[model samples]
Target: MEGEEVGIRHQTDGGQKTTYGATGSRPSSGDERTAQIAGTSDSAPVAATDDGTSGLKSAQGVPAGPSTSYSDAVGLSSRRKKAIFLCLALNSTFVMICIAVLLPFFPQQAAKKDPSDSGDVQGASAIGFIFSITPLAQFFGALFVGRIIPKTGPKMVLMIGGVLVAGVISLFGFVNDIDDWADFLVICYALRFVQGIAGAMNITATFAVLVGLFPNNVSLVAGTIRAFNGVGFAAGPVMAGALYDAGGFTLPFLVHGGIMFAGTIWLFFTLPGDAEVGTGKKGNKMFKDSFTIPWSFVWCMTMFICGTTIGMLDPNLSPFLEDEFGLSATEIGLVYLVFAGTVAASAPVTGYLGDRYINPNKLQPPSMLVLCLGLVLLGPWAETNLTSKLWRSIISLVLVSIGFSSGITLATPGILNAMHKAGYEDTLELHSNLGGTVTALWAAGLTIGPTVGTTVVSAIGFPKTNAIFSIPVLCVATLGLAVGAAYALKDLYYRQRTGTYSLERQRLLPSKDQSTAM
Candidate 1:
């Protein structure tokens, strides 16, 4: 009854009295009858014998299949994953806000650079130049970070970055004259570069770790991080403006540097060690050098156009708002808050929608369209006779936020996807270099955009300049989307038509385009 049935006639090693029995007990009349019934019936259940044979019957629970067990074990636990993502997002928010805090003060700082004098062209230019210089260092530092991360890992880099940045901030307090600026600038640039390196490592390494740690809801993690980034960019200005008003430029820098340094240290301690996380690989070459593109000139043009608009426009916008609207520091801060708010609020939803419901690549164009509208409103509407033009500018910037968020979410992922498809297995290095390339493009745009925006507006008038300058931005964003789409379409067409796509050859073309663009 309990297990297999054995016959009394079964032989043993030595002659002994033996009888038919079930596994648990001697066979009763009913048990014997059931065993007899099992033998006669073709469909009767059977149990395992002590000798591992199936004899008398009993049922066993079926074990789980491999796929079912695997799914259960690997799928991210939604609650735990969300918590980790939330914390990381919070960190991103803090970092972003810190970076942009100085932006709203640029005009005021320029104004103060020569309080006794008027027409502070040199002062404004110097500030703008100062802002631009950091990105250059940051650009190189980011690449260096990418190279060093696998060896030194993110933990050490972040710790070092924080300390250096704190020192730079403290040094700003002692700057007494223009001569002092040179040393300060060098320090600032160096610190910013290191900060950028740390930023790159922290973000990339964290994202990679999250993907493995969470598994099921990667978009949620990305959204949280990105949303925080937006929040920081938006809120930082207001906080900085308030601080500047109360404590002056010197105080804000000192406090900010100290606080940020503390944060960096906190992150160093609270975050896991490099051993707990995986580093994919590091490459010696710059990111852009790793890839080649077909139709090189076209894509190169597209990258420049895209970079110019995104990077250049924001830096100029702060100053333009000041000169054009006569907005105070608080008002300028509010503008950034709006810009950042729009980005932060939309990032998570957009990330989710892109990752889940919509085709990821397809999201790029619509977002660009929104960005174009934003730029158009900001630039062209400056001359509108209506009282609503100022409000319209605000509305337009909101759209820009949407577009910007979209571009960020799509562009980075899109490039990564492209590289992976093209068989660039060293994605970390590729991404790092790609970031620098984008940063350089952005920096160029930032440098040129302000000079051109101010000069062109001064010459052609604000409305005309806004409209004209916006054209390049619109062209670039649209062109980028188009080229990217074309790349995707070409791959599909070739694969379906000829059963394979020449990815390596196609990649080489973008490289050529880069050289042509340069």
Candidate 2:
């Protein structure tokens, strides 16, 4: 019976297989011969039924299907997927923490000179460069990493990025001893640029992985990820301040680098190796296709605005606190904690709403409105009198966090939903590309925001800059609300008329097809 498929064969009457003798005669019933012939060896293969039950067979005796236990053991379970997602979220949080950790220390770092030399140190422009270079480098990082990911996959990209980030951040500790200001500036700028590239790769790859893992719940998952980032942003400054207080400039960088390195190692082992290049067309065709969805453009613009608003804070906020309130570094960090803490708290809530209750298309106006409110609160309209500074800062931070949670956080899900509705296949490649483009636009805004805010603050002062920024933001929000409402009404009309409503269907169909439908 070597290589023979032996199992119980069921007949139409639901009877088991009957044994036949060598001469093709059936053994007589109630005879030992019949019992001996019917008894098969223990090694005989057991077949499965259609319901995944074992010890069952078809008429022809072929294995019915795979067993349920075997399937459960081999396939990834829901619990395991969530665990992996949590790990990735933690990794993202670490990345954001690394970015924000230096914000509180920038002025001190900028002013430091070699102890042996008593010369004029670098100025605010040097500080500006330090703050802005990372985002500028990220622009290129996002652009190239998007294309490279299709070949290397996310796991390897993250591994490489993690190493680069770890190495570059560790180098920050060494810059403290340099005597020459020019050398110090060059070194800091170079390290930041490399770190930006590494960060871009890590973020781009991580997002692609998340989207690939959960196509149906992109918004919710994206929100969870953002929430983790907010956690990092919330924790980073405080940690950095404490580390700096304990061990000076070197300690924070070294400790963070070690943590990043460890996370990278964890990713290498835990992350699955299923990422592959996208099947969709790239370059001009991809770009052209992205624009086919109206919401894509809106998401990009919204991201840009989000970046700008955040960027405006990076260089200006710390200095503003110092000048206006004379707060110490640790105290300033607490102020930052309010903003990041709020963002962390609100992101998941908004994300959940976006997925379950709020329509992705409708998120833009509300998000913009919230952002405008934050901007206005922080502007000249607020009383900057000494007694009110504390409350003003707290209220403004809370509003900004809420605004960002609703507006910027929804951008990813909104973009993804729009792509899906537009007939694009939900593939890692498409998500990667779109994510990269959006990230790049956001980075561009970040790059512009600090520089613009710095220049504008220098000319018109801080209060005027906030007021000026709010004007355009309010305008954009108003326009977005009108457009979103119009689209909603149009969809309602089509649904009533055709009994099946899809914006993509309406626009994509030819003129002749549309006339017949009407």
What's the lDDT for candidate 2?
0.68
For residue 59, what is the lDDT in candidate 2? Answer: 32
Local accuracy of candidate 1 as per-residue lDDT tens digits, 72-176: 222335575555455555555655655676676645544554443556666556556656665555545555555554444445655665566566655654443
Residue 404 shift from truth in candidate 1, angstroms: 1.7
**Which 10 residues in a row give candidate 2 its minimum summed lDDT?**
18-27
In candidate 2 the C-alpha lDDT for residue 403 amounts to 79
TM-scores of the candidates in the order shown: 0.67, 0.77
Tens digits of lDDT, candidate 2, 318-432: 7777787888977887888788778877887887887666676677777777777776666344464434365776687688778767767788887766675665544445667
Task: Name model 2 segments beyond 4 Å from true.
Answer: 1-75, 114-122, 322-329, 382-389, 492-499, 503-518
Question: How does candidate 2 fare on TM-score?
Answer: 0.77
